[model samples]
Target: MSRKVILTCALTGAGDTTGKSEHVPVTPEQIAADAIAAARAGASVVHVHVRDVATGQGSRDVELYREVVRLVGASDVDPVINLTAGMGGDLVIDPSDPTAQLPGTDLVSGLERLPHVEQLLPEICTIDCGSLNFGEGSQIYVSTPDMLREGAARIKELGVKPEMEIFDTGQLWFANVMVAEGLIAPPPLYQLCMGIPYGAPASPGLLNAMVHLLPEGAQWTSFAIGRDQLRWVAQSVLLGGHVRVGLEDNLYLRKGVKATNAQLVEEAGKIIDSLGDAVATPDEARDILQLDRKAGAA
Candidate 1:
């Protein structure tokens, strides 16, 4: 483990996990505080997704994102913020009437999904590379090719790095197309998402294949959901990539143990240490990801 691993803490995802863990921050204030804590606990980056405080549902409100970024900027610890641009893509189809959309559908244009990223201009924002079957339902995570191109252009225009979220190999394939098309900037960043329903499963062979598919010199991190979260930390480090952990991907630090974002980050740090590597600092992460240190500043 001679490599310096960049550890990212996904502060609070848009998943329906708030009820399962008290540590899942729903409000802007709580999410910001959790991000700060994760940075203090040895995370070089914090990936964020805002939630509605009243309903505990994932929100696309730019106001909430503004507040979260404002609060994180005000903090002493300076972790590179990675805002998620993967929302507003849920298309829950009606089971009986397949043509009709259900109540949870939030299909919007790619540009519409990136208002917060444009306004805040965080160092990094995610662009999910393709659509997904998501879970055991009629739901789908829509990210069409045209949509991705539009999102990638906007992200580049904002001078923000796009953490291309690849759920399957097909997504990775299309992402390379974007890179070739000059939409994704040099030294593209990728997040190899695994272990979700209908996406790539948490398999060592599959992870290796995905890594092989990445463009040369790409900066990447990999994560799995639920029980495989911590396991994937070591797996990612061994594969010569970075690591992501937090309440977003998993709720437990161990069996029967609920985890806070900070706790999850600490565990990831320990895993990195055990592998004979050190967790990267914010400045180091900036260099590795080819990002400006002050990119997020207003």
Candidate 2:
């Protein structure tokens, strides 16, 4: 019997990859089109992060999220929608004055990051589990314990499944604590984000260790960035987990070759098929994740 794998395409992350890859969608229409195309290409879910059309940087604008969600809902394909609540947590502090925020800072409270999630009520929304020294700079992604507790409670109330974004071992530990406290519902969903700077490296041993730490009956997916993106698909599936791929994680399908969101999804599907595992359909993914579709319907 073939294992069913849920493939998620992260359309446009809150990263600065737009300038590097022409295929990275910046506008709502482009993002939605990519989501529909990815679904057609065998993606079970589309993880979305809206960008500022003018600056090409990530934005927490509810209007942009609304537009993308509306467009995807109106389309023929019905892939599961997973909005990112990972924004509004960037904190770039000044070197000289620790109290002074830098130019790139976009800090806000946890609840402030979920206006779009609250309005659109997507089936799944991301909640970055903890703070991190993001990338190679003074930038830090802040998500305190109090903030996470508040956010998780609200997400539970909204009936939107929170995909806990675990960047490191400590984050995973905290996530398990949340589960122990009954903050996250049964079959808690997790996304093990690897190879992103100071967080957990894209190592197979580490991934396996993290998987072991997940609460029993947890649903999880794993992904890596750059050259490891495609390879991580197989790694994830082989380890009894789902997979994630898209322009947000990696710009190229191969060396010197750029990839579209649909292309990534197609390649991931082929990998799953070759491994004797089938890529789950959107509906199958819903069942696996135990999502309440009607609760998230707009």
Candidate 3:
């Protein structure tokens, strides 16, 4: 367990939740500013996913990614920018006509997902480790083995750290395989995403079990959705893992309350401090994750 805990604040997720809450940053400026605020609040990393400013829907435009990276990187507040490579994988399948694609299936190819990362080689990018049934909708997030291989390969080529987003145990196995295939460079970085429907349950037992199963030399973090977000912060700390917080997996700071990414990160910092541990600074986090090329060579 690293003595220092690195905090990651996921700004705006790729979900269609903009209409749900005004706190969700929809424009590029809003997203980047919110991320900068999170960094100022003690987050060492900012996980980002752009949404269409017009409709507040998910978007994969490279221009948007550039705008976000520019805002965060050029700002006085500097946190490791972790752009999401987990986009364009939404697959809404039809149960009735199993073979026929659903009308809402906006699934995309692996190469199509790389433009953002290719254009803006952020410090880190996320690779969804496997497919899962996400949200209350009839949507099943898709990440096929072939697609995963392609996406992983691209991530490696771009020299970006691939943060493996694992929602289940099977995904961990596949992540291990990716490490073996040299898709992701070692010491693997994992995010055990919990409490979402059709995935692993949010519990200490499950968290411990998943943490136990990480590939050797892998660095991992865990977060539970909704109200359990704060609880999972302490849980991850106790389990010897880092933590991630923000509106991506949650919206409220408390019951019926809207929370900004900075507030969420500030809360996470408090938990880390209470545990007699320091939240890693951006530089310290870069060092810990071996993102500082100099440190890696050393």
Candidate 4:
């Protein structure tokens, strides 16, 4: 019997990719539509991040989240909804005046980032493990220890599983500390994010090391960005972990071919199948991740 692997399709991330690829969904309806399409294409879960309608940048607005969730919930297929709590952590500062925040800064208390999670009570939400120099320029993604602890506790209170987003090895270490401190529940879910600017590079050795560091009995998935997105699916499965793919991480299916979220999920399914593993259904994914099925849908 082949092992079961859960595949997550991250629709539209908080990045500024709308202009680069017209496929990046900017509205709640489009994002939700992509989620449904991905689910039909064999994705066990759909990780989501909403963008502002006017600016096309990531937004922490609860209304956007609510609309997306409602649309997906009312759809035919039911995939596990994993809402992003990774927003509201961006801190862009001026180089000359370090005391002054730049135009892109959206820093807020960790708890403030969970308003949507608190309202919807999705099966799973993210807790970015630590802060990082997000990308080029002075932009920084901030998620301190105190903030993470508080966020984890609140998510726990809401009875939602927190998917710890590990961007670097150090972030993984801090996540382990949280688990040791009895903050994260047993069989914690981890998403090893690789190939982002300055975070853990997209290296098999580095990924293997990170996998080995995970606590025993933990369920985890690993993904890389851009050209490495598809390749990382095979790498992750070989290492006894699940996989993630979609427009949020990569836009092109090949050299110059832009892919839709469903196309990405279908390609990832083929990889898992070729590796002699079967894709887990949403209910199967729920069992694997120890998540309770949300009411309605399917």
- Point to the candidate with the largest lDDT: 2
Clashes of each: 0, 0, 0, 0
lDDT of 2 at 102: 90
Candidate 3 wrongly placed segments (more than 4 Å): 292-298
Higher-TM-score candidate of 1 and 2: 2
Give the C-alpha lDDT of model 3.
Answer: 0.86
Candidate 4 Cα misplacement greater than 4 A, ranges: 294-298
Residue range 233-278, candidate 2, lDDT tens digits: 9999999999999988999999999999999999999999999999
The list of candidate 2 runs beyond 4 A from truth reads: none
Tens digit per residue, CA lDDT, model 1, 176-243: 99999999888999999999898999998999989998888898999999999999999999999999
TM-score of each: 0.98, 0.99, 0.94, 0.98
Give per-residue lDDT, candidate 2, residue 129: 99
Better of 2 and 4 by TM-score: 2
Report the lDDT tens digits of candidate 3 across residue range 96-149: 766667755768887787787777778888899898887665688889999999
Question: What does each candidate score in C-alpha RMSD?
Answer: 0.9, 0.7, 2.7, 1.5
Q: Please, what are the lDDT tens digits per residue for candidate 4 over residues 1-298?
A: 7999999999999888999998999999999999999999999999999999999999999999999999998889989999999989989899999889999899999999999998888898999999999778999999999999999998888888899999999999999999999899878999999999989999999999999999999999999999999999999999999999999999999999999999999999999999999999999999998885542221
Q: Looking at candidate 1, what is the lDDT of residue 284?
A: 94
On lDDT, the stronger of 1 and 4 is 4
